[model samples]
Target: MAKETEIEEKNLLTRNEFDMLADTYQIKPPQFFWQANTYFDTPALEIKEQGAALRVRTKSNNYELTLKQPASAGLLETNQTLTEVEAKRLMEQAELPEGEVKESLHPFIGDTSMLQKLGTLETYRAQTSHETGILFLDHSVYLDTEDFELEIEGSSEEEVRKWLTSILTDHDIPARPTPNKIKRFFTRKQELAR
Candidate 1:
């Protein structure tokens, strides 16, 4: 299940900061699109406990099953294409369609059947490439939470991070502590349940 592993760095921003970056870079509206990500885990959140995540993301009628695990370089991602039916079973019944993604999850969460759909997060994302890395500005909504984030993924984490820092600093924007989208969604879900 070793595949598509890479480092992704994220920074949270205020509404003003997001708009400022957009204006500063002259980012066009044509680069924006929407995506919905549905996350899954055991009733006790075994995946997160193991420092891993599982999700089925749907974009333009295509469904993909992805498993993310913590790795030395960054996060190791194993991805597999899922048919509409397979995606349905995975989301509705906590079933894996039998493939690399399933095999990858077995080591982390022994019983895949325990998985349950956490919730779906919808994001309107704008992206463009720079000399250092790919830049993403995301506005996401899930449950009762809405947030904006800046993410950069490039050939190397250090280079991309330094580049991101310089831009934020030049604009006098304080980088806020940021959590991955899954964490934010799970946090809000837990809060509302309590």
Candidate 2:
């Protein structure tokens, strides 16, 4: 009975299924796309400044920074979900000076660019509980202008690393690649147990 209850309580949603539901109901995308995965981990970080002129370095290490503008009035708490217009309103309510707005286009999902790049684009792919097919993202971008991370949906993390390596290496940028946190869970847990 306990095992059955656990299974029932642990129902998972897949990426495509979730996306379809979002489209059908006109629900805004969840703030943390990575939540769809069993575990979320980012192995590499890229640091770039606004204006595309310079990359920020922390003692020779490049770290990515993201800045987000909320559309609603007042500060949007972490884990808060907001529509695009609401996010914009939040930004204005914060009384921050106006900044540049950019556009991003997704190759697979119609020729539309709902993707926004404020600074550095941190890209990735991962499996979701909703569908068998993987979310194929050409790239997921993170903006340094905002204080948030861009959780890109990809078919897998390996695919994401390949894409990131290609783009950064092409641009003469070096990155520090790390493994997913899930893979290290056992190790970390065992260490703690000791």
Candidate 3:
């Protein structure tokens, strides 16, 4: 398990604002690529209640299983690299791999077999480096809902937050409450279920 802290700040963006920010960052349109993320939880939503999220993400045919948990500093992320075969099995059969990520889930989910696919969200994303850290532009679609977001990821929360705020101020873009993608996805999933 490769464990690390994830610190980022986010803001909701309009399509026009997204384009304007790309210009501000001097990024071209061709920089974006697709990323697919499949989320998992017990049928009873045990993982959600525990304030954790489990997901398999694909980038350039490489699969990574990651478990994100609440931490004192930010989110504690534990990642496990998976081979193509392992990723295929998990996606097709809901068979979670036996490794660090699964082991870490034991406290919240006793029987690993309880894990099930919650849903998938796909994003067309691009990023550019910044002195503060990195700036990510995302247009994600899932459960028939689409949204745009700007994320500032850095080694420290305070830095990311300050940079994000400055970007908003400089661009005259109003800040919108931005929750993490998982929460947004799960909230929409629940809405569709009703």
Candidate 3: tens digits of C-alpha lDDT, residues 1-194: 69999999999999999999988888787899999999999999999899999999999998999999999988999999999999988888889988999889898899988788888999999999999699999999998999999999998888998999999999999999888999999999989889
Winner of 1 and 3 under lDDT: 3
**Candidate 3 C-alpha error for residue 89, in Å:** 1.2
State every prediction's TM-score relative to the real structure.
0.94, 0.21, 0.97
Candidate lDDT (C-alpha), each: 0.86, 0.26, 0.92
Off by over 4 Å in 1: none
- lDDT digits (tens) for residues 1-194 of candidate 2: 00000001011224454354344434454422321111111111121111111111111122211122222322111122334453443333321112221111111122212222222223332333333222222123232211111122334545544554453355343453322222233234335558
lDDT of 2 at 72: 31
Best by lDDT: 3
- Return the lDDT, model 1, position 189: 87
